[model samples]
Target: MPEIKKYLSIVALGENRDKLARDLVGAIARRGCEVNECRITPLGDHFSAAMLLAGNWSAMGKMESALPGLAEHLGLAIQFQHARPAEPQTDFRPYAAEVVAPQQPRLLGELLDFFTEQETNVVEVSSQAYDSGLTGAAMCTLHMALQVPVNHHPQTLRDAFMDVCDDLHADGLLDPIKT
Candidate 1:
């Protein structure tokens, strides 16, 4: 059986997240580690990357040492930490959702609260706020991957989320992720 080492997730942001990602991945590979997954997103003037990596425990120190130089050279901060392994809960259903609305304080907090109240487990979340250039309206958008217990019917969660969206005057959707 292969050793199950702890996973390390890195989130880096800077003027050039792509370069940072490439450099970081190269550095990790050089240290004999493998990157499992990486995703990059443009956050207005900045770029961000979320990466999942795993390898021999002994290589962690070498990788950590390389991080500072890359972070400094890239002119941004690179943060990493051990990630919790996924739960093998067959009773949980996967879901993908999004919420879009005019930018406002407390919108994100309220949505998170609803998720907590519903006993949903958030796997991944990314959000951005920007101006609708045509309308000049400030808009915020949230995308999330979730695991909802099978006991909670999809429609039930949708209805509850819709209620929150309605109250917040936002548009949202909750749909099962196709496995």
Candidate 2:
């Protein structure tokens, strides 16, 4: 198999996060590339992300072509490149995920603590879950950098996260892991 690691950076702004993710994934999938993970960074100005994908070189080309239109639609600059491989391989498959949790209407000390303890860096987080008419909640997006080891069944990560949530009393709404 020809293994390769591709790094794609996408910038999308606005309060509508669902739309941004949907557009990016849709555009990329249409090109035959599967997004392995997206780490969104909220830096007070805009949304930035480093996405990892696995697919053939042809899919990479298709994604590159469609990125510009998506960027324009979201009003953000898009920069992408492939990771330097020490050896030739088909594509890179990583174990990662984007988890969203709903915090209490009160302060987010507990929620923030979970991110810190888990070592899952926060790319971007919002304290406005209720702004869209949902119940009072704060949401965070974590980008897990370390991929799962190749030879063992995955454990430790999710349980650790759940332990944190249990201590902090935060409710996790979405926890779909890509392992």
TM-score to native of every candidate shown: 0.81, 0.41
Q: How big is the positional error of residue 57 in model 2, measured in Å on the Cα after superposition?
A: 1.7
Give per-residue CA lDDT, model 2, range 1-179, as digits (tens): 65764544444454445456667677778888887766665655456566776677777777778777777777667777665333522232244444445534433565456546654444344443333246544554343433333442335656765666565554433243464
Candidate 1: tens digits of C-alpha lDDT, residues 1-179 = 88757678888888854465577667779876678778877778787778877776777667767778867876867899877655587988999889999999999889888998999988788888999989999999999999899999788789999999999999999999998
Candidate 2 accuracy as TM-score = 0.41
Q: Which RMSD values do the candidates have, in order?
A: 2.6, 8.6
**Can you tell me which runs of candidate 2 are displaced by over 4 Å?**
1-18, 84-179
How many clashing pairs does model 1 include? 0
Highest lDDT against the true fold, candidate: 1
Candidate 1 clash pair list:
none
